[model samples]
Target chain A: LNVNINRKRKWDIGKLIYMENVSAEDCIKRWRNEDVDDEEGGDSDSDDSNEEDFFKKKDENSSKESNPKQTIDLEQFVPYFDTFEKLAAKWSSVDLIKNRFIRSAVERK
Target chain B: MSNSKSPLRIFEGHQNFRLRIVLATLSGIPIKLEKIRSNDLNPGLKDYEVSFLRLIETVTNGSTIEISYTGTTLIYRPGIIYGGSYTHQCPNSKPVGYFIEPMLYLAPFSKKKFSLLFKGITASHKDAGIDVLKWGMLPVLEKFGVRECALHTLKRGSPPLGGGEVHLVVDSLIAQPITMHELETPIISSIRGVAYSTRVSPSLVNRMIDGAQKVLKDVGCTVNITADVWRGENSGKSPGWGITLLAEMKKNWCLFSECIGDAGDVPEDIGAKAAYHLLEEISRSTAIGRGQLPLAIVFMVIGKEDIGRLRINKNQIDENFIHLLRDIKKIFGTEVYLKPVNDPESDDFIATVKGVGFTNANKKIA
Candidate 1:
């Protein structure tokens, strides 16, 4: 049964949507459990601990963190765009954020 | 049959032009790309892309490239792979790695011994820096039966004011097709790195190394990293320090990740982020991580076997990768298959392909 579901999931290619508002620190913390937000508390509006708990709960529910909003880590843009004006213009700005949007209302496997 | 013989088609505005061009050249298939950013202002190919095409021409003989006056359309006809000593002044706007990555793919297959002296930014956050390639790509080449390949960073160049230089020498050998049926579980034997500082205080390198090593140790990885501090002429026009970490597995496979210390970016964060990437790769059961998948796929597409397989992440197979896979199948008739696994131990998927069994153009008829 799991294999059948796995086969179905493999065919499901989610369109990559680059989320902009999410900062690099937020991504690293969420991905690696860095817990930097607890220390800095830079964005006073959002409670860091509550957000972490939310992520952990969601992650447990689904093995893969299937967040609709994906952040193309700023680091990937390098080497390729360092000096190329076109690549820099294409990927450098917030275009990644503009590129993809979540279409499916229901997260179908 | 006529349609199949036609040049492979590519639309405009795609970023992997270099990869596509190299693939076309290696496969000896003509390719035509049109509507290159047609709707955009200052559309067509960029200065760096043109420079990249010129470099591709230098490595090959009689390669034909045609571009529209507005630069919106272009056609490329590949030529023989004739590699020899070359000295190229890389466009100041891009790091040398942009040129180096493609050069690494084509060098071993050249008829003559490939020796190159590249002058430009040696290390940048944008491309795989010289440090990353030396540890990551060089070993991969060696694994594929490429011998006597040497990658050296002669000088360190930073961005904007890049004057870095690198000398690479690869033997003239026909690339023997390889079959890497299964990627062994990555047992990180050691974590090695270079904390390089150019036109900056040597202490910066130490601080970066300390920050990076702290994270590696915390993650239970061997902190076997080293530091390289350059002064005066060796350091380029700009002042910066960054770290490049190479996680060497028990097998020859290497996973490299790096970050640069930019304005407002703390050196410690740069070091820690690079370490985190290495930890992420080590944590994965896949043979290649996201960083090296594209490069590995390039080899798989060109191998002499009828079939090749490797374990990889499904998320790693992005749009550019999909484009490349399709192009390879069209140009070389290689069929690629992706199989997903539900194993609780590893989330990685299996990518298998039947190669076209392409041999070098220069191979003597026997």
Candidate 2:
């Protein structure tokens, strides 16, 4: 199927990685499973689809990203409130660290 | 050197805290504590998007795990961007601005005993990285039984090798199913102790060649060596061959030792072109055009992608890549075969040609 992908395929390795391996994500969620919002609770009826969408390939030479709040875009695409709640926390900590450093550096010392 | 003979837990501080799981035993495995304490990083690099892991761990008989950053760099860095800046002065003198991303790690020892298995890493040693490995990981591993230190290269070009162009170098090893011992000795010896530099020089290449041989000899192993040089960087005049030479290097190494000949004071780009055209002949070979073989070198690539970095016109990547492969095959002729494949971790072009390795002004190993 003459795949006309503009994303350079020769050097892009996203496919070689195990996108479905739940260790890294599970590790984070296993810890952040506490902050669940019952109001927005949703069963992961489409985890397979979510996994597929989350792993959709992107452009190669891309250089920009969406805002921080929009960080949940990948998660937003996920129907599992459970997975989202935890991953959000795990990722938030990372953001917290980066944000703290950037803010502090931009401010005083 | 044996000590307490128990499991060890180690950690290092980078932009992020990377936890390493080590299994040291006939059965002893490292159990992740509910809490892992790590110091956070503040000093940072601009244009940085993703966080890199600085992992350290100790496994007693359970299984020894080694996070070798040095190997990661050696395999990948040599094929990355050509112009690597190295300031001669203080603080700025350390101007290397590239990092490697890791995928998975494994220690294949059946019965772990005093073993330091560095699964993923760059060959170049960062001051901070070494400090963590040596101080934090070493002592911890020693407690369990990490006697010999061994590491493997996971993803190439992610960390890059000594920076250069005139001598664009990459490697390909087509072998039948080899045992761990056979692979380990050669792999370990190939890059036991190495260094990096942006400028490509014959002296440096010779040194690496010599070092490789010595390491292999010391490890008591017999192996063959083939180097395909591609000199197509910033070279403007020889654009056609410059790019072609790179594709060629994926399956071949330069034959000339002095490929970076007198630039004749030509423009850097022109010199670059000349260098690429002449790379294969650097250490000139009388049999320039010889019989070809059918072989394909496939590499998976990955990298940080923002919103609109790439535009794959067609649906699948393999489709687009096949076209490039056809072009390469046509250039190299019918006898020779070439294909390009994408990996999941890196986002660089990997040219796969039968029975050959690929190289360019900058390095990329897919």
Candidate 3:
């Protein structure tokens, strides 16, 4: 009788070759920094003016280093990143319970 | 005992309570939980949590659990998992899924074959339903070399007057460490589902299947959904209907989506919603579903000593996920690395971890 092996295969406990490449400390540090970034981003809306000023200074610094034409191009790219950051901030604060994708995935059993 | 040297891991709040217990049990590290819903008008452990603890005690050997008078503080020193045939009546406050979720973590590491008969609400809004476990979770376990497992839904029960029954049988991992290398999301081979209704109109099940098929037809895959209508005795005390959809992908991966009918919910709408949810999951193209990430992480951490890799969507990370990582580090001392997938357009991240190679000490060697 032909049977699907994938449906039948079960193995017992045995040691496999250990391969460790990533450092646990660095991973923890990265996760911590990401958390800090999330907290800051969530509160960024309160300091809107400061953020705008910072962006303006960044644009000015870029303009000083490059030609006038490239500066205009850089200026055009700045708002895209700004909007992306704002979107990220908004995304983080939105309750996952109310999110359509998450609710759909969770509501049923 | 190794438990003597390990300091009790301290935790606060009631978040991820079941997971904390599972980790403590698997790692053999004692834990102290305080301030569990302490500030609430009704403080302390919920009825469902107590029921879960009772079930844990029934399944394990020599476990010690201490709860404060007000139930605000809890100290748990886990015992050896001595899995055997048992029956547990779950609380009505939460569904049987709540209990079964944690049991999945502990059962495979048990000394004997685990056979548990759970009687309670099988489907609810609060937890993944029994169908999800049978179709979705069991397949994931299969990827980790756990094949001798099955979840049979003996009865259909909905909330308020839950009388459902489900039987779970899992054999302990005796020879090989759990290993899975599913990083790339495979194309879906087919779609299968079950639309079940209890103490309700049989027509509702058909409507739900129609709604799901209407949405899934455009995906160019075989969609087969069965309508399961239960009557007296088999149907629980309350009237309810729901749909569970499973997208079976190539390479033995399955993604599940479910929608339970609430008050004034249309069967068609529930079906469409579940189908849309499934489409969203397919689009994300992660190895594991967002809701299954925590369970997958736990399995990865406790797997073989070798490295395991899983692809998960970075956007799925939330407060609970972050806290789980922190708690794992505290209890198991295992940290997992997250590297962005090569595709710039996708939000997927590859999580890499070296397992602790946890084997069942209670299982006798032949």
Candidate 4:
């Protein structure tokens, strides 16, 4: 029975091998899922995401506290889930588009 | 059968164990403590450690709280060495032990800020779920004396998944002790009686053989050396071993160390220098201490590109290592041994050098 197997598994000290022995995909998947956990779960203050948020929060908080008048979106610097590689590539291309508008008559492409 | 004064029944109730004072605060979960032997075979702590443990007395500070957490929070450090199972499992799984003093100030929100924002959750909710973790961190704090929390799994629910964390605090005292038992022991494979390890990289394997050759040569014992890497599909840089390795010799002991880095083609001289540093660090650790210093030193050097690019005019990498081994014999005493690794491809080598030293010296003159 599954119950019996669960008990056997529970008592087995060797189950810890699974901890040190996760698959690469499993490890990465687990790592990536941290973001999703932070989104759905509180108590997260998830380190994976809050780095930028800390700076933005500090800036906005200071602004609001000091000026007594600024509306800080706080989200200005915190972008959605794009990897560092993905964001870097996308930003370069978007900046290129802005640069290309210098003269529509001639296109480098 | 003697008189009433016979021996007075010599029952001085001194429980030799420095109060098993289980400091459990915050998480009201009740855990029964029949007895706790540190999972490792440490007979007892050294004087300094015991003296430091005396501080726990001041922290436990005559509190009547049945269980008082020595600190505000807990922390865990997931490094290349400690790996995963080295972690203490507190909850979610049928728990075994509890963490004692967790410095709590660098709260969850503070630990892995990057991972948190990725979830795009409100700070309040995020703070509630993973930020204020009460368990899984006490030992890390008591061990390393640092502020960083990586959460693996902390909640109580279905699909209960969690990660570990680390962070810094403005001012905190809960020291994170880096448990040494994790690395000092050799991992044995359940499948075989002989010690089995998977991540003994090719170069490291060669170095181990080299180091072993010297000691074996000196002792007049012929030994077999094997080599391989962890092919576990999930395996990358860190490979987990199944058993702890202790040499089966009578009077000799061994110390093994491996360094992995972007050491771009370090020369033989540099290798010897790195060897010196690694040896110094291993000798300094409270775990291996002086008792095990004399017999053997095994270094497992790991790197793909670094080992191949290394070159010395006098001899090949193996020969250079042998020279270093011979040098070790010249210095302290002529009994040190080695297992120098040679990685032809990518210039990586792992050497498990071993030696015999006179551990009876009384002073710290050196």
| Per-residue alpha-carbon lDDT of candidate 4 for residues B1-366, written as tens digits (9 for 90 to 100) | 011232211101111112112111111111222212223254223332233233222222222212113221111111111011122222322111112112131121111221211111101110122212222122223222334444432221111222222221212222121221122222111110111123334454344334323322222122333443334422222332211112121111132222222224222222222233222322223222221211112110111111111111111122112322332333222222111124222211122322222111111224
Using lDDT as the yardstick, the better of models 2 and 4 is 4
Which residue runs of candidate 4 sit more than 4 Å off their true CA positions?
Answer: A1-109, B1-204, B211-216, B219-224, B232-234, B237-246, B251-366
Of candidates 2 and 1, the better by DockQ:
1
Across B1-366, the per-residue lDDT of candidate 1 in tens digits comes to: 012365556644444577778778888778888877676678898787888888888888878899989998888888888888889888887788878888878887777888888998876756778887787787777766676788878889888788788988987486555765764445555568888888877887888887777665533335566889888897777877788888666667777778788877777767766766555444442556665666677777788765777877644555345545655655666656765455664456677776666677666535
Question: Tens digits of per-residue lDDT for model 2 on B1-366?
Answer: 111243332212121221112111111222222211122143322222112212121211212333333211100000111121111111111111112111111121212222222221112222112212222222222221223332222211112222211111012111111111000000111112212212233244334334334322322222233332324332111211100111112112111111122223222332233222222221111111110000111111111111111111111223123322332232222111112225433222222223222222122335
Candidate 4 docking DockQ: 0.01
RMSD of 3: 14.2
Q: Go through the candidates in order and give each one's C-alpha lDDT.
A: 0.65, 0.21, 0.71, 0.23
Q: Evaluate every candidate with DockQ and list the scores.
A: 0.05, 0.01, 0.03, 0.01
Model 2: chain A TM-score against the true structure = 0.19
Provide backbone clash counts, one per model.
Answer: 7, 103, 9, 105
Tens-digit per-residue lDDT, B273-293, candidate 3: 777677665554465775567
DockQ, candidate no. 3: 0.03
Q: Is candidate 2 or candidate 3 better by lDDT?
A: 3
The better-scoring model by DockQ among 2 and 3 is 3
